[model samples]
Target: MVPIPLASEPLRIGLLGCGQIAQAHAAALRFLADDGVARVSAVADPDPEGIRRVAGIVGDLERSYSDGRELIDDPTVDAVAVVAPTRFHRDLIAAVASAGKPLFTEKPLAPDFSTVCEIADTVRAAGIPAQVGFQSRFHPIVRQLQDWVVEGELGAPMAYTIRDDQFWPTGAVVPGHSSWRAERSQAGGGALLEHSIHSCDIACWLFGPVARVFASTRHVFGFDVEDVAAITIEHHSGVVGNLVTVFNGVRDREERRIEVFFERAAVEATTDFIIGAPEDSLLLKQDGAPAERFDVDALRRATFAADGFDPNREVFVYQYFGYAAFASALRRGLDPVPGIADAVRAHEVVEAAYQSARTKGAANVADLRSR
Candidate 1:
């Protein structure tokens, strides 16, 4: 399908949900709107309060719907952002694709990766532009590392390690506040599926696709879901990596870090700067050589904080960059980065890890298809 010419008009974006992540999507759309790339034209949610909350940020919507299907049916919406819960993803994505509208959605695409192939087939048949919310791929630090990998500065990642040390979204979740995370039926799994999946996506990007995994998971927080998880992923490139995630930690900070050991050099990066975070740091060291360090500009999040634009971490800023990249891709008639295929690949690995944990044995990523 041909893209609507950028010179013609801005794409009208419709939001499908109004939960916490929806707020971040609305905020990011504001940045795109300012540049005439896209604008939030409609929003839909079952709860009036949710609609009201999103409307506060996206401004007066051209239309509002009690059900997301109605919004997808609205011809006025040029593209849709499916920010609904995981359980709704398979159906919502199929609906949006059936409508032939380009769409963006939060990651994991499907809960247990069961419907991924069906979703993939539907999107391929429709040929609508699609992108996933793996915003970490858009992080400046991640890009810097990727560039080095391409240039062979970090030659063929001999070993990779990613740590997603985060707070919240675990233990004693308030019933309404992302409590879906604790529900295996709703969210699919705990820390490994929800949090570590981001790092898993990074692992796939930097180290190559995961071929197999052996995992151990624990329900340390009594959430009926595993709050702690450790997984060893073997990438097809002969690079083995370890990812550890825990949601039970109470800390004053969050750290999203990656370290890659190459043939002769090592690279380190921090600052997946989600919201109201400060500067980020990156260091590269080679054997018996001086280490080089650099500071990555976190899209003026600190500047916004210093000038009082947003003093709270609730306003996510990195996603602005990710969605902006997606918007540009839409205008150019190109597939967006971290697109649906990427989501499927990441989910397949996550599913394999969970299966391995359950069976107390190794699991192949491709085995998700049979189960």
Candidate 2:
């Protein structure tokens, strides 16, 4: 398909929720609007106060709806930005697919692997571009790393290591607030599904598909679900990907980072920077030497955060580039970096990871394929 020119008129967008992540989506839409390419046409939420808050962000001229279905059915809206809870993802995707509009749903696509397949099949059959909100792929360093790998810069990675550590402060989750994140029925798994989805997708993108998975989950922090997890995966290329997901505040680690070891040389790329090659000591290092280093700004020619690596730990709170990329793809026929199919695959990985953790054995990826 020939690539269409960027839309001359602003693409009309609507939000399905007004939660914390939804604020980031709205900010991204505002950024697009500043460029004269997209606008937030409407917002929908059951809470009138929440609806007003989101609507106020895009201006009062935008439409507001008490029910998301009504907003989804609105004829004026061209695309939908779904930042609702994980539980609502399947229903919202199905609803919007039936409505015949492009969609961008936040990650973990649904509560489980089975529901994710239903959403994926629905979007696929409808022939519409439905994007999963895996924003880290849009990070400049990540994109460059993927490009380098695909271009054979690293000479085919033999293994991948991903580490993500976050501290979900106790009081951050308001009590009696009825948050979907705290409920297993809504979030599926805790940190594994909620936070690990990003790392899982990155693993899949770096290495083709998952072959097998062995994982473990423990509620070390006493949350409703597991707060710490260790997952080991075998990719189709026989490459191994080891992932460590932690929600502890004790360890001092980067918020997100991936280290890829290839046949030619090893490359370590983080959300803020990338380093490799003999020039910077990336490959020629005998012991503890700095390699070639590429900072965030040096990558995409656009800087999302001012302070570089330590910009903001709350990644989802300010994910504009990704949402803009998704909006552009849906409006102009470009491919979103991590679309709904990727989400389905990520869900499959998470499900397998949890199963492996429970059974204390390896889980075949093929066995987890939804019916």
Candidate 3:
């Protein structure tokens, strides 16, 4: 019998973005710095000034680069975090794969399926660990819901409903803010690429692979791409899921919930709660009312127990766990959850959704896989 190896070495991390999401990643990396588990040894971004500013916030990054290739080629950097922009993911991931270093990257992997598939193949051939930054999956409720789905708690999910609605602030300087997003060459799609990826991937993680899809989307806000979209997905396990994404700036965000309807009953878990059900539907609820809420404190305790984290520890929240978990997986030579192939699948779905909307017909994800 072979003894299980423990992850004991500290990881040397290189960060490659200086944007808003990069700040979140840096916040997570900073927590690891405080814990002595890992450190951001180097940084890089197209904007030298932006790299310097982020380095200042992260406390003395050893090297900075205007081009990410330099940082990837740096001998001392053990792993890389590619957060530059959606368009840059494929190139950065390729560089990291060629260098044979582990990677932690932001979502959707790349803007095109062909490029995404190529990157996935390269990472697998290099045999280096690669983790995608779908950090929201670490949310306690989501974790529990996935657990329940796998454990047959919901008796095999029959349907999944996703509502993703939020008003992206106009003041923030996002890529294509003025024109980039509207251009097809820059942003793959509008809301589906920029925002729908989160909900779509979460759906894949919680339910299963989306086998086929039908969707409708349009440029409601005068953007070149759709600002709102509706999609229907058929999961491999024969489950059906419906997703609605919009930027209507509704008075409240109702689109943040993922509700799974099952044979036994239903499970509704939002970021705010681990469970929601009809009061009369289960033993966990109150009277015969149709709605009940799960407690946040209890969910935190559950997460701490499973992850070996301090229940009372105050840190960078979910992002820190994502970084730490990916680092640990890399050290063990295991591909971290949501790697390059998953990104390719995500992009396929995004493209399928866009095409279905335009053609008014169901789109097969496999058909887009060739592109």
C-alpha lDDT values of all predictions: 0.78, 0.72, 0.72
Give the best candidate by TM-score: 1
Position 316, candidate 2: lDDT: 33
TM-score of every model versus the real structure: 0.90, 0.85, 0.87
- Better candidate by TM-score, 1 or 3: 1
User: Residue 181 of model 2: what lDDT?
Assistant: 62
Cα displacement (Å) at residue 79, model 3: 0.2
Model 3, span 188-228: residue lDDT tens: 67777777787788888877788899998877667666778
- Per-residue accuracy of model 2 over 25-138 as CA lDDT, tens digit each: 776677667666677888998888777666666664368888999999988888888888788878888899888777878888888777878778888898777777887676
Give stretches of model 2 more than 4 Å off.
Answer: 1-8, 169-178, 249-254, 272-290, 300-318
* Clash pairs detected, candidate 1: none
Off by over 4 Å in 3: 1-8, 169-179, 250-255, 272-292
RMSD of each: 4.0, 5.4, 4.5
Task: Give the RMSD in angstroms, all C-alphas superposed, for model 1.
Answer: 4.0
Q: In model 2, which residue pairs have backbone atoms overlapping below 3 Å?
A: 280-291, 280-292, 281-291, 282-291
